[model samples]
Target chain A: MDKKLEVRDGSVVLKVNPEFYPLDIIYSAAYVFLDKAYVLLDGDLKKEILVKLQPKQKQDLEKLGGEFLNELINYADYKHRAAQTKTIREYLLQRALFTNDPSIIPDDDEEVDYNEILNELEEDDEELDDPEGIAVPWEEKYGQKDEKKD
Target chain B: MKKKIKLVLNKNFYDKKAISQAIKDFEHIAKITILDDEFGIELLQKEPLEEPLKEEFSNYVLGLMKNENII
Candidate 1:
């Protein structure tokens, strides 16, 4: 393992390579230590990043630095896995949505005219089967009810 | 008697806006001057504080960076 930590008086300095650990990952890892330690960032962002951590309570500086390194690794792994599974995740989401509502995925080369379909249904209404006259209008079925029934 | 301390922060890693906000927040405790990237802070009170002013100031700026989503 490369020596990334340098223990100083009551503090530890970490030298991070931006190529391996991105700037956002470093920031995320550093944010975790803010409550436990006084964190300061320096050095060239493009080339190298220097993180200085001084614990609020009495603690081993080397141990704190090691924890910070682990956090960086954790975030880096998370970012890598997210990127790798992005396509599959999108595919799963589309599959789920299509399953829930098939109409969500439009048919290509087929244009649907809802008004035409409605007109066709109206023209075929007379041929529909209604044995008990269930489809009759309410007023036609019962003749208008006595208006002033007491 | 007044105590003075200096902190040099890198522009690439630290946001100037966050640092400015920190300076404003700690203005009551210390007299701060910004020269380039260096902050010259002179303590106004002689008594020891609950936390060291310099470290607390640095922590406050980092907190602001996180709060402002700069980091």
Candidate 2:
């Protein structure tokens, strides 16, 4: 098999095809390695991208190259799956928000007054029947007990 | 002794604004001159640093690009 990565001068170089890995995906992968290595990108964006990774500490260049390649695949798959589920994700979000609060959805036919709704809620709270005085606080119904001697 | 390093950043890969910001941030440490696609950096201090200046500068530019959402 032909070698895809080049190791020289304590650095690993990868010639990434732009078609297989988009520029954004490459950027995302490169960002993840910023702290671990010195990442330098140079090449034709339309054709091939040359990614150079110089590890901060002593390590195998081949392994570093392999990790970078894996990151590229990881970002590519994430982007692909994100694009595929975008519509569904948006739909689910809409459903969740609407279910949680139907008042958030705008209604063209009816004008809503927030203050009026709040007033109605207050009135409803006042109208609530508490035959057993269950709504009363314990402190309000009973006097505070005297502290026991230590 | 003053040291100088030349870095040629391709227009297709690098964002001009990010490079400008990186240069501005590192101006205290080095005198950076921009000529089209190339950046000429002249070190002001003579002391040996922990990391290579050229690599650090390039990494700074890359960081700026990512932080500014240019890449």
The TM-scores of chain A alone, one per candidate, are 0.63, 0.67
* Candidates' C-alpha lDDT: 0.80, 0.80
State which docking tier applies to candidate 2: medium
For residues B11-56, could you state the per-residue lDDT of candidate 2 as single tens digits?
A: 6777778878887888777777676544444444345568877778
TM-score: model 1 vs. ground truth: 0.67
lDDT of 1: 0.80
List, for all models, the DockQ compared with the true complex: 0.65, 0.70
For model 2 the local lDDT of residue B14 reads 75
Output the number of the DockQ-best candidate.
Answer: 2
Candidate 2 lDDT by residue in tens digits, A15-121:
99999999999889988998889988888888889999999999999999999999999999999999999966865565567668877756654325433454575
What are the candidates' interface root-mean-square deviations? 1.2, 1.1
TM-score on B-chain, cand. 1: 0.79
Can you list the residue pairs that collide in candidate 1?
A: none
* lDDT string, candidate 1, B7-41, tens digits: 77767777788888888888777776667744433
